[model samples]
Target: MRLPPLKALPVFEAVARTLSFSAAAEELHVTQSAVSHQIRQLEDDLGESLFERGGRRVALTEQGERYLEAIAPALAQIERASEQLRGVTDSRIRLAVPSSFAVSWLIPRLPHLQRQHPELDLDLEMLADMPLMSERLADCFITFRYRQRGYSSERLYVERLFAVCSRQYWNRVRDELDEAGLRKRGSGVTIRPEWLTRFTLLSAASVFERPGEDWRRWFAAGEAKLPADAHVQHFSHMLLAHEAARHHQGIALSNDYMLDTASDPDLIKLPTHELQTGDEFHFACKTARRNEPGIRHLSQWLVKQAEASGWKV
Candidate 1:
């Protein structure tokens, strides 16, 4: 049996499913005219009209609907076979990761993973908020949220917060303290936690508002009290706060996962106490899809990377 041009099947399928040539073109990474030309070719080859066009909208005719029903399952089978042959059951893994983590953590390490699994593709969606845990939105999600809503998940790492500032800012503060003859205490130069009040305190407002992830909790954990009139600047996102601190704007509280030590050499970590926020990073997916070859490979790779960074699990 002869096949209706193999190339046209996908174009036809996409248009039929979306009912819009523009949408189909976008999904196929082609122009709208390209989709129209392919559809025309297919219709001419089949000697029947596949779509009923009115104004700017189009719909499948009876023949087109019947054809779709017949071809969709066959196309799926072909895709599955191709994936199986390639030893990657999922050709692409759509991952939803937090923006900060994506920028500071995952991206730096992506090259290694891509090199190892050239046949596998990763589609990353950097989201500010938690992603909807469904196949429609993403194949997997890496998040700090504890609530998984019954999804299968593996703990990746636990984040500990500490104070950080630009080296330039630290030098200026040290010089001022030295000029005032207040830099040394006991046997060495020391800056008290209260000294932080002297500088503008840059903070992520949302993180501070979270139960155990606040400046008050961090200060308390360090056996210090936050000054009542601490100079402060608030940011909604930690990435911005970190950047602010990097630029010598102020001191910012940073967590382990959000700071790339190698990338920002000028950022100096303040020798202050650390506080565990009780939040664990995790990779989550639908329970049934956990064992898929692509998901399993990615999960194992991520775990290995996390373990290399001193995370226990």
Candidate 2:
């Protein structure tokens, strides 16, 4: 039987997964030069270039992505079998999620997950930006929808964004705005978009984004001009922005999944300026393992939880 270089296969998978030689080297507990050499040897043996190397950045070539898909499941199975032989009961499912979602949505409902699936354990890797593939980082990922050839993806939730701030903060700001004739209450809470500039704007880096693109979109949706010099404070994540808003720091943008106005006595909405960004969040996993009991259970539970929380799936 003809076989490929077995040792080189793991090196290729690690490099393709991380898209960084140094990262792959660290993961495999080997030297960076050793990783490069193994990759070269693998490419020589296959007669196909697996990666596109440009300066310090590395990306998998089409061939490499396909090759990784072919091997990743096999590798995972082997690891599982080895663990079992060593008396390790590996029921842990790793889930990668956006940091804000972890804090505001998923973490709070974790007890339900435990009650529903007592046999399985969960390990969460909360990230500001989710990786594109499930093969590299964790077993499953909650992320934006994009076509990945060998992966199964299902739309899980969408954002319903609106401005929010602490009720206490608004109590003070309301009188200040009323004094300035900026508070106009006519038919279910309405405000001029430009009026938002009077108070500090709490910007979440993941939502408000660099150069204020999402913020611009929200202003455009409201048909209000975004101030050229709006006073803005930036937070690295949405939860931090929310926390800041809760403490009377500023107005924070919030989504439906993260906020339950009925339950949260601390927050009040800007109202009537809601913007559905049309960004779809998806649950994704390797297509080959989509039906695995543990993965399927988690995915369904997540969908159910989102639906219960008013996510339009």
Which candidate number would show the highest TM-score if scored against the true structure? 2
Residue 86 C-alpha lDDT in model 1 = 83
Extract clashing residue pairs from model 1.
Answer: none
Model 2: residue 212 alpha-carbon error in angstroms: 2.0
Q: Write the per-residue lDDT of candidate 2 for residues 32-129, one digit (tens) a residue.
A: 99999999988898899999999999998888888887887787777778878998766778888888778878899899989989987899988767
TM-score of 2: 0.91
**Which residue ranges in model 1 land beyond 4 Å of their true spot?**
1-89, 180-182, 185-190, 210-213
Residue 3, model 2: lDDT of 76
lDDT of 1: 0.79
Over 40-77, each residue of candidate 1 has an lDDT whose tens digit, in order, gives 99999999999999988999999998887677656755
In order, candidate lDDTs are 0.79, 0.81
The ten-residue window of minimal lDDT in model 1 covers 182-191
Q: Show the lowest summed lDDT stretch of 10 residues, model 2.
A: 181-190
